[model samples]
Target: MELAQRVQSLTPSSTLAITAKAKALKAEGHDVIGLGAGEPDFNTPNHIIEAAKRSMDEGLTKYTPSGGIPALKSAIIDKMQKDQNLTYNQDQVIVTTGAKHALFTLFQVLLNKKDEVIVPAPYWVSYPEQIKLAEGNPIVVQTKEEQQFKLTPEQLEQSITERTKAVIINSPSNPTGMMYSKEELQAIGEICLKHDILIVSDEIYEKLIYTEEKHISIAQLSDSLFNQTIIINGVSKSHSMTGWRIGYALGQAKIIKAMTNLASHSTSNPTSISQYGALAAYNGSDQDIEEMRSAFSDRLEKLYSWIVDIPGIHCEKPKGAFYLFPNVKQAAALCGYDQVDDWVTALLDEEKVALVPGSGFGSPENVRLSYATSLDQLEEAANRIKHFIEKHKG
Candidate 1:
């Protein structure tokens, strides 16, 4: 069967593959410790769940505007004004199925054939593929762990070309869990403004920071920067509402309207009840979020300490998000594998532990492990990993 050339060329997400494999092993009665998922281990807050129930009772399960209901949009606007010091009218925001969908729609609306989007190395797995789906070329700028895996202004300036259309910035980054400071964001935002390139700020992990390092949206740096930036965020990560499929984008009304029109024809209207649930998440107390962040912080510290003790494994302490991306280049060689992916496969097979190799995240020397699980499970997983390394170390 002939498939679309675009679909044929797409790379499957390594995170999902390993997670599925882990599940398969677990189903076969193996005690698999899967660490490949990127979601919080917490359940949705009670208030949010109650909101969804209320929506259903009120017959709000029907279709809504493709861009989202006004109540949710208002809640999002309030959040941006309070949290980000950025204000936007309703016309400037469009709600989509998830932050991923918001980005996919934006890329479709913003890019032309062969247009380039500057993606930093160790990026979220979906960015490059989404750009490719939109027929845009991804210009990957590599960042080092020593520098906290952040793209420098000079690197951003170097990656831009006449065909460059936009740059995607993920604070509290997915694979690395490192965030850009306000000054760093300002510098990068300035370069994008100077180049007249759009900035796509993915702030889905905004509330997951674990250090003194705060999450700053590149769009919030300055008025000029805000004008040229599109902010993508949702309650998925912050409120543990990943399954609800409610995310949104905020930007210039023109771009947002185009994205909304695209959404209209495609995924016309995100789930109605989910939008209500997200509104509750935004308006309710952030206690649940803070609690989850605290748990993740503790797990990160313990996991980092354990990782450092493992021979041939090194990683900078991740300041945010729930994952630890450790450089295991030497570990792979010790395990007699040339590629980290093969080493990951061997570890999963031998130890029943799942990890997403960094090759898919554009860093072949490392692997990502999510700490979004119970502390006991994490400790056991750490022990298993250490034993695996000890057994394989040459």
Candidate 2:
């Protein structure tokens, strides 16, 4: 049997593969400590969960508008206004299965065959694959770790071409957890306006910042940029609602309408319960959000110190998100391995500590270790990692 060419071009998710191997090791009675999580270890807030239950109890379990229920759309609108001072109508938003699904849907509606989308390297693993699945070309520009793994205005200017349609900017980035500052965004936005390219601003990790610096959307830099940018975000990262599967896109009504039309035939509507839960998430108190963010901050500080203390291992402290991306190439070299991925494999085998290799995220020298676990687990994982490096070092 022949697979579709698009499916053939798709790369399997390394995150899931590592997770499966870790699970298998655990089942075999090994004390495996997996650090590949992409979701919060916390449960969804009680209020949000209660709201979902009340909605079902009131018989609101039926399908909703393909874009989203109006109340939920209004809640999302209020969130943007309160958080980013950006406003949008119900028609300008479409709730999808998840933020990942929202991104996948946006690419489907926005791209033509061979249309190019600029992706910064060390990107979220899904970005390139989703672009290719939509028959669009992903133009990945490698970013420097010294620059906090951020894309520069100079790099963005050089990467644009006639075929360029859009570029993705994931702030409070996934693997690296670095964010773009307001001035940096303004510079990047100007280049986009100059080149007449679309800005795909992904702010799903907006509420998880660990630093004094705030998250800035490229859209809010100016009116023109706001119009030129499409914002993709969701309750997943912010509200500890990963399993709820509610994410959305905000932009021009025309683009939202087209995406809605495509979604109507596809997912029809995001799960009705998830939308209600998200509505409560936006409408309720933010105490839970702050508590979760604080926990991540503590983990970031402690785990980072432990990771960098290992021989030949170096890491830059991330400002947001729950992952620490450490440069392990020198460690791998010291261990007599040519590839960091192989070093990752050896670590899992020898220490029963699982981590996602950086090769999958478009950087071959680093590895992503998620700290979205208890402090005890994080400390134990750090010890095992330090032990592995010490034992294998030349």
Give the TM-score of each candidate: 0.99, 0.99
Off by over 4 Å in 2: none
| Model 1 lDDT per residue over 1-394, tens place | 8999999889998988999999999999999999998898889999999999999999999889999999999999999999978999999999999999999999999999999999999999999999999999999999998899999999999888999999988988989988888889888888888889999989999999888866788877788998999999998999999999989999999999999999999997999999999999999998999999898889999988988888889898888889999999998888788999999999999999999999999999999999999889888998998899889875
The residue-level lDDT of candidate 1 at 152 comes to: 95
Mind giving the per-residue lDDT tens digits that candidate 2 earns over 1-394?
Answer: 9999999989999999999999999999999999999999999999999999999999999988998999999999999999889888888888889999999999999999999999999999999999999999999999988999999999999999999999999998988999999998999999999999999999999899988898899988899999999999999999999999999999989999999999999999999998999999999999999999999999889999888988888988899989999999998998889999999999999999999999999999999999999999999998998888778774
The models' CA-based lDDT, in order, is 0.92, 0.93
Q: After superposing candidate 1 on the true structure, give the runs of residues whose Cα lies further than 4 Å from its correct spot.
A: none
Residue 366's lDDT within candidate 1 is 93
Evaluated with lDDT, which candidate comes out highest? 2
